[model samples]
Target: MSRAPGQFTVVAPGRVNLIGEHTDYNDGFVLPQAIERGLRIAVCRRPGSRALLASDRGGPPLDIDLGAPLLAGRTDWGRYVAGVVAGFQRLGWTIPGFEARITADLPSGGGLSSSAALEVGIATVVETLAGQALDPVAKALLCQHAEHEFAGVPCGIMDQFAVTLARRDHALFIDCRSREVAHVPLGTEVAVLVIDSGVKHALGDGGYAARRRDCETAARLLGRKALRDVSSIEWPSLEHRLREQEGRRARHVITENDRVLAFKAAAEAGDWPAAGRLMRASHASLRDDFEVSCRELDLICDAVGRLDGVFGCRMTGGGFGGCAVALVDGPRASSIEALARTACAAALGHAPEVFLTTGVPGARVE
Candidate 1:
């Protein structure tokens, strides 16, 4: 594709949580990796102070006023773009009008964080045009704020951090409270399998917010700053003080945080079995305590977990519905995929979309 003098192309990958879920907002640890699938944007500067945005996915074109103080646009996806633009302006960058065309392979609502990809991709585009880069952590926080203020999702930082800082052949381990990061190597001996359940989840739909509220209430009752402050040792003593639902919510976060640390250690030691076991346990906690797993997700995890050569399987996202990720022996990935397809089809009356991916670099201009 030919481009104008100031034109640039930026790509941002989606992410799958390896162990941690819903813990970011509570200032806990999370392990996630950026997948090969993501959003691609071809963009260039335009003359006027308006953004002309188009998507290959068949949405009406969005025309956004860049000069306006409030840049939230009319469409759901447009809000992500506008939010990014607003973020750059907040940083005192003078943004001119731009035209962007977006194409994405990332599945939206599958809990793979397509929204973060869009936000980060657009942020990269702005940075590219300005010939400067924001500090990686600051850039990630900018995108996270966009999701909170514009998208109204009140998301944690895991998705944005994964999409912004992930390194190839590794998973990004983030301590959300401290903003410290380490890249855990994911060698080529295993494959990462993502199976989409075909059931979509929208976090804006109160379920996610309700869970966050529960955690906050739990923290308040325990007299802690956030759930992260409530250590596993303290959990047993404090669990009974909260209501039933709040107790469950606090239990999930406290334990899930511990699982993230254990999972990272297992990954570093190349102990696939231990890592897989942690994944399974993490899923169970999300289902029973966090209350996010759906029937389809549970079915996929159960079928895939039972297969030969599979280390473990679990639901990998926000969890009401989306995808399950499995770590399996690379040599047997194809056969496991086939068997998983047939088994899930027989039980659910249809086969799901399954694919394998490796960790890749985060958002950048190509």
Candidate 2:
């Protein structure tokens, strides 16, 4: 096959959340694994000053005007890609224009960090074309900036950090406030079965942003910085302090934080039963209080909850619609997947796409 001269191959990994829902923005702990599903970006020099960006989904390259601010909002999904270019430039990461193509196995809107995988893939390719190497944290921050500042999603660092820096065969425990990284071993003996609800969720849909606002308001009601700053021991006094609007929000946060901590310990100790229970509890809190999970997500959770080999299961993304995570025994993995698919079809009248992938590394240019 004839190849373009200056083509740099880039690989960016996706992520799986083992525990911690809506906890990253709270500056709390999130444990996520970098799964095998990811995006690949290929870049080569283009003769003209203008850059061309394309994806394997069979579309023309998005020609971004380099001289323009690049900060302007975009209606198309291409903005996520262009936004990375803007982030690199703003942060003074030397970069050059190049023709690019992206291909992915990661399912979009599956809540599996598909967007982060794309951003990292693009950023890695862009930097490689510019002959600039970035540290892991720098790579994460740039991708995050692309989503938040450019793509206009108020997401936290879990997806980016998990994709950019997570260790193979492990989950990363992130202290969002301090930005501390901890690599916890995820035993390969267990399997992570990701079942898609096939429900599409926009981050801003179903008042997701409004829920975030409520969280902040709840924090302020108790005189804390964010939900992460609050503790379970102090919930009584804080709960009394908050009225209807704030009390429920504060209650979810306090208990959710506790669940995250316990889930982390359970995962570390290889206590699959405890972890599974925590997953159920977290889903309940998000459903009843946080108002994130929907019918499909709840259905999957309930279906998985009844299975024997299923250790833990819960919705994995921004909610209102998306996929859920289930921990299953290696031996019964297939059976669990089959039953989950059957249940999903029966519950929602549609089969779903599911992935059981191994944990991999961050993006790299080859």
Candidate 3:
């Protein structure tokens, strides 16, 4: 597709959860920040009921009809665009069908929320084209809805919220139940390192949903709205009544929420060591209790643990496989990354992809 004059470009960022994992759905707290890497969608209005979309990732240009029925099957990237368009329509905004060319620096399937970046970026484009401004919070919710209704992923609000509302130089402390945000500054000289284990996971593919179901079961058994309302002290009283897996799932959510709060306080106080300790503990709970971490993710985190100048490491996304985020000494970032690479390669027989990045501003039209 050729670039059109007057095309508006919007960039939306991917996020790395620093200390919270799988807690969003439980209505617990999460600490995440937008990364510099993200996706860009360039859009411009067209004359008819159809829109065209092309991507730098290489695929046939997608032709979509604004007034037509949803496609019968998943069309890869097309599903994301169609989902956003449908999202707007559901809001009673009849946006013009347009042409879009997507460009991205985010690593797809690395658990950095590349999908949320695409969804939020395109949602911004559609909202802009309609001459309507959406509140960031509402926009984030709509994007989450799009993923659930259109993309078939029962994702929580963390990814979309971070992509749309994160501020530069700070991590977002989100109360998933209240949808309240607090920007916590990292005052220490720590840098973020993301190591992609070359292992990919599609959360909608099943495991994620199963884990969610387990949580739901625990909540029902405990007579709570969600596990978020259940205290760690109250969990043991209900644990025996649940299946072993359900009990473990409940334990992870309750305990992880505690860690998120601890990490937030540590981050704000420039206490990197305490924050790191919580991060490592969070990963261990996810691995042993939640049963989400895969071998590759474990190897990457283990590699980081042995490296000096690294505060902590853990699998940062929905698990199964993705990236491990490490908080490292800013001045020794290079050496820590090199050590992590060598260790991961030795264990996995191939070097993992590593990115050294910083917190960046959230979505905006450029």
TM-score of each model, in listed order: 0.97, 0.93, 0.95
Give the per-residue lDDT of model 2 (tens digit) for 1-366: 556678767889888788887888877888888888788777778665567877876555698865556774786767887788888777666556677777888777888888888888877776677777788898888888888876678888889998888778888888889999888877855788888888778884536677778888888776789988788887776677777866776677678778877877887898888988898888888888788888989988887768778888899877877789988887778877888777767777778787677678778765
lDDT tens per residue, model 3, 1-366: 545565778989999999878899989999999999998887888898788889998878998888775532564777877887777776788778788888988778889999899888988887788888789998899889878877788999999999999988889999999999999886449989999988888997999999999999989988899999988777777789888889999999999999999999888888898999999999999999999999988888887877888888999989888888999998888887788888889988898888888888889988
Q: lDDT tens string, model 1, 214-297?
A: 999889989989999989997888888999999999999999999999999998998999999999999999999999999999
Candidate 1's displacement at residue 4, Å, is 4.5
Better of 2 and 3 by TM-score: 3
**How far is 100's C-alpha from truth in model 3 (Å)?**
1.3
lDDT per prediction? 0.90, 0.80, 0.87
The numbered model that scores best in TM-score is: 1
Angstrom error of the Cα, residue 177, model 3: value is 0.7
Q: Model 2 misses residue 19 by how many Å? A: 1.2
Between prediction 2 and prediction 3, the one with superior lDDT is 3
- Order of candidate numbers by lDDT, starting with the best: 1, 3, 2
Count clashes in each candidate, considering only residues at least 3 apart in sequence or on different chains.
Answer: 0, 0, 0
What candidate 3 gets wrong by more than 4 Å, as runs, is 1-5, 69-75
